[model samples]
Target: MDPPEQLALREVFTAACRAQRAEVLATAVRRFASAILTNLAARPVADLLADYFKPVALYAICELVGIPATQRAVVAESAETMAASMDGVLDPERRAAAIGSRTALSRVVDSCLRSSDGSGVLGHVARNHRRLDVPRSVLVHSFRLLLSPGYMSVATAAANAFVALRAHNLPLTCLSRDTGVDELLRYCGPVQALGRLCRSDFDFRGTPVRKGELVLALLGAANRDPERFPGADDIRLDRRPNPHLAFGWGTHSCLGTSTARLVLSAAFGRLADQFPAAELVSEPRYAVRAVVRAPEALPVRLTRGSEGAIR
Candidate 1:
C-alpha cells in the first residue's frame, strides 16, 4: 500500500466515488436529504441522529455505491456494528463480530459488483477498471473504506454540528454558506485523529519518530490551535482564511470531503428553510466511541416555518 500502488488505488476509488461529477452527487444528496427531512418533520419529537442524519447519510452512500434497496438495511446494520466495534477493540467478542461484519460487507460489495450493469460507481469501477492492476480484495476494501466513514463520519458531523449550533444560539442559516460549514466542520468534525505510518525517520518538534512506526496526528487539537485559528475556543461561522484539518491534510485526506459538504449543506438548508423553529427536545447524549465524537441520541422537536415543508 505504498507509492504507485496506493496512488493507483486512490485513483480507482476517486472514480468510483464519482468525484468528478459534483452536480450529480449534489442532486442525489438533495433528493435523499429532502426525503429524510420530510419524515423528520412528521414527528413532533424525533431522535435526529437516528431519524434524520443517519438515514440521510446511509441513503446517500448506498445510492453512491449502488447497493440495492432491499439490501441496504443489512448493509447499514453491519456497517454500524463495524464502526461501534472500534470502541471495544480490546474485547475479543467485539473484535470477532467486527471481523464477521467486515467480511459480510465485502461479500455484499462483491455481489453488487458482479451483478452490476455499469450504472453506478461500483459498477463503473468493476466494469471499466480491470486494467489498473489493483487487486479485487483491495478494491472491495476501498469500498468498505468509503462506506464506513462516508456514513458514520458524515452523520456524526452533521449531528454534532446541530448540537454545537444550538448550544451557541446560532441559527442554522449559518450552514447555508461554505465558510460557515467549514467552520462547523473544523469545530465539530467527528474524526478526532489521523493515524499514519511513518515512511522515514523524522523529527517532529524535537521528538524523533522512527521509520515504520505509527504516528497519530491529533486533528482535533490541531484544528483548535490558537496560533493557527484566532479565538480557537469559540465557534466562528464567519472565520476566514480557515485552513482546517478536519478532513486531514495532504494526499491522504478523506475522499468523500465534497460529498460530506454537499450532504450537510442540503440537509441543514432544507431544515432551516422548512423548519426554522426547530428546537432541541433534550440535551443530546454523546456517543462514547474511540475515534468519532457524535451523539448517541439527539432529541429534537420541529416546527414548520412559513415556507412550509420541502416538496
Candidate 2:
C-alpha cells in the first residue's frame, strides 16, 4: 500500500464504517448464494464453488469499494489473472494470461473514468484522484490490494465449507433450519495462516521474535488453540463459543471480513440445501502458500443427484 492509496483506503474504510451496516453485507452474500444454488443445481457443490464465489465476492468488494456493477467481470478477470501467477510454476501461458487480464482491468478503470456516473471503486479513484500525492500507479496498486488479499480467501473458504459438508454428511435440511453456522466456520477455518512482520522484539508463547522478523500467524493453530477452545485438536462444528482468528486480528484483519462471511454464509447455505452426499474422491491438494492455506485441488465425487441431487 503506497502512501497515497493508503490515504485513500483509510478514507474508504472510514466511509464504509460510517455508511454500511453488517446486515447489508449479509444480504449481499445471500444474493450471491442464491445465484450459485440456481446454477449448480444437481451438481457437486465443491466443483463449482470457487468459480461462482470469485465473481460474486469480487462484485461485492467492488460494490463496497465504490466500483460499479457493470465492470465486475472485468475486475474478477484481473483478480483471477493475478491469482494464477502466484503459483510456483510460472510460464509463457500464465504470463500471457496475466498480461491479458491486466489489460482488461486497465480498460475497466479507463471506462470508469469515462463514465459520468462515477459510482464505484474506480469512481472513487477517478473522482478523488490526486495529481501529485497519488500517482496513477499508486491508485491502481491500491485497488489491486483489495482484490489481491481476498480472492484466495473467498475461494478457499467456499471449498472448505463444501469439504466440511462432505466429511460430516450434513443434509440440505440444515440450510433452511436454524443450525450452527459459526461452529462449522470455526471447525474448518477457511484460511490456515496469515502473515505478519514483527514490529518490535517480543516473546509469544515462549517463542522469541525480533523487530522486522516475518511471522506466520498460524491460523490453524489459533483456531485450534486449546487455551481458547477446549479439545482444540478436534473439529467441533457446533462449538458454543468459537473465538478463532480465521480472519486475523488487529489492523491487518481481512478487508473483506464482512464480505467473506457473506460469501461463506451464502455458499454453505445453498450447498447444504443442494448436495447432501458429496464426498472427496481424493485428498485435497493443499496449497503451499505461507499466507493463504487451502486445497489447490479438491477432487470429489457425487453419489446422488444427477451431479449433486438426491441419489
Candidate 3:
C-alpha cells in the first residue's frame, strides 16, 4: 500500500485499539486466562498450545474484531487451516487449501461489516468506510490481515515464551513485569522474519539492492545480535534498554501491537500469579512455518502452587 492509504487505514485500526478498548480487552483476557488455567490444572496433562493459548488468542481476536460468538468456532477452524498452510508453502495442495480458507474468512468479514452495529474494529471501519480514501476491498483485506496476526501470531508467541521459560527454568513471575515481557518478546517472538519490497535502490555495507527487489529482514537473528544486545543468547527477563524488532519497526510495523501486548501481558501475568508450578510434560512439537515459527502443541502439567491452588 502507498503511504497515504496505509496511513489512513492505520488510523482506523489505531482508533479501534486505543487505550480504552485495550483495557477492556485486557480485562477479558485475564478472566479467560484464569478460567483456562484452572481447567487445565484439573487435568493430568494438557496441550497448552491447543487448549489454553490458542483459545485465549482466538477469543481475544474474535472479540476485538466483532466476530459473533456463533461464528467463532468456524473462524478458528479456518484460521488454523490458514496457519497450517504457511508451513506447506511449497505444496500445491496446502496452498489451495489456504486460498479456500482465506476466502471463507473474507466472507465472514464481509458479513460482519454488513451487520456492523458500531462495535469492534469491523464496525469502526464499516461506519467510516465511505469516508476513507482506500477501497472497500482493501479495508476487508486489512481486516483479514488484522485477524491472522492477532490470532496465530499471539498464540505462537505465548507458546514460544513457555518453551523459553522451561528451557531456562525461569519463574513464570518473570512475565509479570513490563521489562520482562519486553525481553520475552525479544527472545521468543514467533515472527521469524519480515518481508518487504525495496522501493528504491540502496546499499547496505557494500551490498546493493535495486528497486522492486525483495528484501527480508531477519528479525530472529537481529534480536540475538551479540553486538547490539550483550549476552543476547541468554534470556534476561529484566534486560533494560532492550530495543528489539520482534515487532517490525517503522511505518509497516504490526498493526495489532497494542492488542498483542495486552493479551500476552494479561495471560502470562495471570498464569504467573495463579499457576506458578506449571511444567512442560514433554518437548513441544513445532509447526512447520518459516515466517511465524511456533509449536504446534505444548504438553504441560499444571501443578498446584502455594499461592494459587489448583481446584
Candidate 4:
C-alpha cells in the first residue's frame, strides 16, 4: 500500500485491463468461438466442454498472457490441479499439487520475462514494472493472478450459462442484449468463493473477525441472496442494475472484467446463433472441485436449424 505499489496498480490497469483493446479481445473471442463451434459441429455427441470450452478458455487466456504454445498444456494441467486446493481443503495430495503448480508456473513466468518481446500483457507488464515501481516478485505472482482463474473461471462461467439456458428452456434470443449475459453470469458464475486475510479486527453482522484470520466469502451464496436480488434463485434475463459479485468488488475486482464480458458475450451469442436449439442430452455433472463450479462433462444435443443430433 505504498505510493509506488499504488502507482504500479494503476499502470497495470492501464496497460492490460482496459476495455478498448477491442481488436485483441475480438481475436480471442473469434479463436475460441470458432474452435467450440467446429468441435461441436464435428462430434456433436462428445463432451461439449472437454474438447471445446476448456481448451478455448486455456488458449484465450494464454493468448492474452503470452503464454507460449510449448508451455500451455503443463500450465493448464497444473492450474487445474491447483484449484482443488482452493476448496479450503488442504489435504496432502491437494497441497502437493498446488505447490507443484505454483513452482512450475513461477519458473515459466520467469522464463517468459527473460524472453520478453515487449508484446502481450506479460511483456508489457514486464517491461514497465520498473517504471511502475512494482517489484519483480509481485510481477511474477501476477502470472498466477492472471492465468489461473482467467482460464478456469471464464470456461466454467460460459459452460454454466449454457447449462442454465438449456435447463430453463431459454431460447437464444435471450442473449440479444447485454442484460442477458449479465443475468446469466449472476445466476451461474464459476467461482464458488473468494478468500481474504483479515488485516484488522472487524464486526460482521455482530460477529467479530479478528486480525490474522482467514475469511472465505461465499460469492455463490451472496449472488443467490434473495434480499439483494428478488427471485435470486431464478434467471432473470432482463434484470438491470444487477450488481452481482461474480467478479470481486472494489480494488480487488477482476482486472479482466471487460475482456471476460466480451469473450462470454461472443461465446454465448455464437451458441445462440449457430445452435439455436441446443439441448442437454443428460444431466450436466459438475466437477467435484471446491473453488470453481464447472461441469465435469456437458453432454448436449445440438440442433442445426431443424436436424438434431443425439449424445
Residue range 138-227, candidate 3, lDDT tens digits: 877888888887888888888999889778777777766778777988987988876789989999899999999989888999999999
Candidate 4 off by > 4 Å: 1-7, 88-90, 306-311
Q: Which scores better on lDDT, 2 or 3? A: 3
lDDT of 2 by residue, 146-191 (tens): 6655665577666676666666665533323212445555667665
Pairs with backbone N, CA or C atoms under 3 Å apart (clashes), candidate 2: 42-308, 66-120, 66-121, 67-120, 67-121, 305-309
Question: Of the candidates numbered 1 and 4, which has the greater TM-score value?
Answer: 1
Worst 10 residues of 4 by lDDT: 302-311
- Go through the candidates in order and give the clash count of each: 0, 6, 0, 0
lDDT of 1 by residue, 1-311 (tens): 76766887777777767634667767877777777778677678988888888888887777777778887886788888877776554556766788888988998888887874844678878776777887789888888887888788888888989888878878887788888889999997888875789999999899999999988777889899999999998998889999999877767777887777887887788788667767788777777666678888888888775322211
Worst 10 residues of 1 by lDDT: 302-311
Full-model lDDT, candidate 2: 0.60
The residue-level lDDT of candidate 4 at 255 comes to 73
Better of 2 and 3 by TM-score: 3
Record all residue pairs in model 3 with backbone atoms less than 3 Å apart, i.e. clashing.
none
TM-score for every candidate vs. truth? 0.91, 0.70, 0.93, 0.90
Which parts of model 2 have CA positions greater than 4 angstroms off? 1-11, 17-32, 42-46, 66-74, 84-116, 120-139, 172-182, 203-208, 238-240, 274-290, 297-311
Error of 2 at 226 (Å): 1.4
Q: Evaluated with TM-score, which candidate comes out highest?
A: 3
